[model samples]
Target: MVLCTCFFVPPLQAQESPEVDIGGALRFNYNLSSWKPEQKTRGGDFGYDLFRINANAAYKGIYLNAEYRWYSDGFGGGMLKQGWFGYHFSKNKELQVGLTQVPFGIQQYNSNNWFFNLTYYVGLEDDHDMGIKYIYTGEKTEYQLAFFKNAEELRFGNDSEISHSRYSYDVAGRNKEINQFNGKFIYKFGGNVLQRIGFSAQYGSLYNLDTEESGNHYGLALHYEASYKDWNLKAEAMNIAHNPENAASTPDDTILMAAYGAAYEVAADFNIYTLTLSRNVPVNWGPVSALQFYNDFGYMQKQEDDFEDSYMNVTGVLLTAGNIYTYIDYAAGYNHSWLGGNYIDDFSRGTPNANWEARFNINIGYYF
Candidate 1:
């Protein structure tokens, strides 16, 4: 046996890999007319809509993500959209704890329209809260569960100026609503034409600080999406049941009825349905590398027996090239606030009380 003389080799130090990425977005908006019926002639507004910064850091299996934004008009100050830290067991699973988005409805929404759908106005979509959440993304399924405290509307003070636009609706006042739980699941199937179906639910308990009473709110949603060729279609329907004590005395209840002609009293419920269709145009010329046409429709039915139904329709075209994007939309509404019409339960303003209006909106964004 040949003896092999070997020198001792020092073990290499295990290096810790770290990564960080920073990004930001700048947006601008120009309006041809205002949405409020009382301010029909107001238009020619041009200014910065939003400026935001996003950052992410990762080391080992731990990560941190944050987003801070500045809005020009309504908010009038910087705000934190999301800030979260989590441990990632794998690429498909994570447990996060911090201020993050409430995973109750379609993630990021399906419409390219700037205002989104009616669900957003009711605090069911694109809303964030302080929460602890777990997410699991499998090959054909995705699941999310979270428990939140101090939702977006309740977390902020009531000093901000209120506008009739979509960005100014705050349903949760200074109420002590806590222990809100949100859950969602989505399953994907189909081959060439990809398809997905999802279900989401949220529940919370509210304690009226003013009246010393307690109540609850529950919501459920079903959504579906499909992609065929260059066209994408999405449909969502949701029901929200509100059972707040002394609902007639709540500011949100009063605003809800006054703004949208919907009452959220004891056992008050409402249903919303939204449908969107988008297609990519086969044009990749000049500075515009991509073009898409989209249309969105939303309908809301209130629980009151004599209440008239509300609807909104938006049509727009979007263009994208590199990190620059822009969209132009024409929106119309019946019995909707942001869309133009102002519906009141009493109809005291008469039959022709500016029940409908149309506006042109353009938004441009740059990402870096």
Candidate 2:
């Protein structure tokens, strides 16, 4: 998951004296994988993960939010996560321009685990792009409409080589994502037990430089979230399809997706279902104040016959202590990109009857 700082300003305080806040996080990760026998033999690997800087500023009715991150060389070295300028039209309406998060599926996250759900792998969750967005907030409803010109471009012009060293995954290489439109609506039910139901839809074009033609892609999702005291639940179902006009020699069953300095093949059409359940337990154990235990599960059903499906399940706990946060997770997957199968073959033309692989991980971060 793409982790970043978030700022919330009350709607009633739209116009404020010039204010600026800068903060960031430092994180480290350790993991042992079943797929890597060498690593298992040596126990595990622990190393620096990332350092990020976030800035937020507001003057009058205008605001700016930006984040930049630096990761280990193996991951994307350095890149902008998100930067946007927004204007408050009124107490409940705003418009944002520049690189912004795509309003889809769950709002901030669909899963509480550090690995996130499978939707994130396919760019259905926590994806960001260059776009203009309009947001409206009501007492019991919310709406977001956006139009993205294309995915984040490292260099101008279509002839330039696509860079995989970015934060959010998108169609890369010969096929480029362009002219995307998104609309999301949500209704909230307030009571002792809070609940929210939402719908999201997106349509975009895939411009193939080799074929010099544009194919289309679309997605629809239905999501629900509920909270009752310390218990929380989230569920979502989505269908995504990509029809790319590629060179005749290329296969149509898969598309190229790139992120974090790497590109991989993903199934062209699939349906994804995800569910997350969690409970918060409060405690006073020295500096540790609370812990949240969660289980996140996701399944991807491929549309093509004979193609293998993908499965991911994560059981984790989040520990909160002042400025420090930590996650301990046991994650397992079958036909998953980061789990077992070959590096680039897990999501596309996956191994049938693939055995499940597992990983144990710990991530700790300090936020200012």
Candidate 3:
């Protein structure tokens, strides 16, 4: 999520801006889930509900990041997490020196809803670590490398709804990286396609700061992507399950998969995208996860002539569960510079817990 407002004026191209400005996303959340809370006496509580507020800052190139949210302290015995910070380096090289997330884990895929679809189509893995990153930029080339100290991986299906980073995969996976390193490269061709390759490796214990044998670990990742006009495709393969600890008492434990996605402009004001994923639960293909995949389909529609602002979108999961639930969103509002900052847009209802849940969020989205 991000924020950028400039009223009483028209859209300013990059060449129009002189100084490096700052911006961010200020989000407020209100939801009601069907899960009941536990009471001390009855060893049970009632349904869980919460009101939350989150703010994220974005500085042109200096920094762009968000928070973990702690607006509501009481949410079914859950833990709170603060956001992270990243420092921009010379050119594009950067050193994220805060509680940033792990950059590995997911491949840079092509999807119209990648930016807004939180659960239905996108996967954001958060790891608590004081890390650093180096990004290389060229005319048609790009690369990135990241590392972490106290690394942790969130559970797949268990990290949603309220997205609480509570139990770590280190339970069955005490696997932490005392030090983790990753690298990726992207090159453009004459046609309208991009080629990408990513590699990640790490070593350490359950506690990144510890030296326990039971928590030692290491792994690697590989990915590829191509894009043309309003269409794109991506695939990722990995072997995180591989170990000298296979079920056959052999060094043969691994999980691998390949994913594909495509998008097309259905109309001038609407774009449609669909993704298909397959995860290899049977065997490991070399250093790749055989079939760890899911299918995500979405539609993005918007209209902006010279009047108001509006958006309607829907993302659905056609693959496995624990991967993504579903989402529906509609937003519309207008901005004017002559007056103080003020805006409101809410074209949705029946959200949160309804069978056909609809998420309609009204945002004042004020900024100076």
In candidate 1, the residue pairs with backbone N, CA or C atoms under 3 Å apart (3 or more residues apart, or in different chains) clash, namely none
Candidate 2: which stretches are off by over 4 Å?
1-17
**lDDT-best of 1 and 3:** 1
- Best-to-worst order by TM-score is 2, 1, 3
**C-alpha lDDT (0 to 100) for residue 218 of candidate 3:** 49
Mind giving the per-residue lDDT tens digits that candidate 2 earns over 1-368?
00111124344455557989999999999999999999999999999999999999998768999999998778889999999999765677778899999999997888999998999888887899998888888989998989999988888875665788888889887888999999999999969899999999999999998888999999999999999999999999999999999899998889989888899989999999999999999999999999999999999999988788899999999999999999999999999989877769688778988999999999999999
lDDT per model, in order? 0.68, 0.90, 0.33
Compose the digit string of candidate 1's lDDT tens values, residues 241-313. Answer: 7666654544333223211223221214678899999999867688888889999988777765545566678
**What does candidate 3 score on TM?**
0.43
Model 2, residue 6: distance off in Å is: 24
Better of 1 and 2 by TM-score: 2
| Model 3, global lDDT | 0.33
Candidate 2 displacement at residue 336 in angstroms: 0.4
Distance (Å) between predicted and true CA of 81, model 2?
Answer: 1.0
lDDT of 3 by residue, 257-335 (tens): 1011111111112122333332224334343322222233322222223223222232322111232212222321112
> How much is the lDDT of residue 41 in candidate 1?
57
Report the number of the highest-lDDT candidate: 2
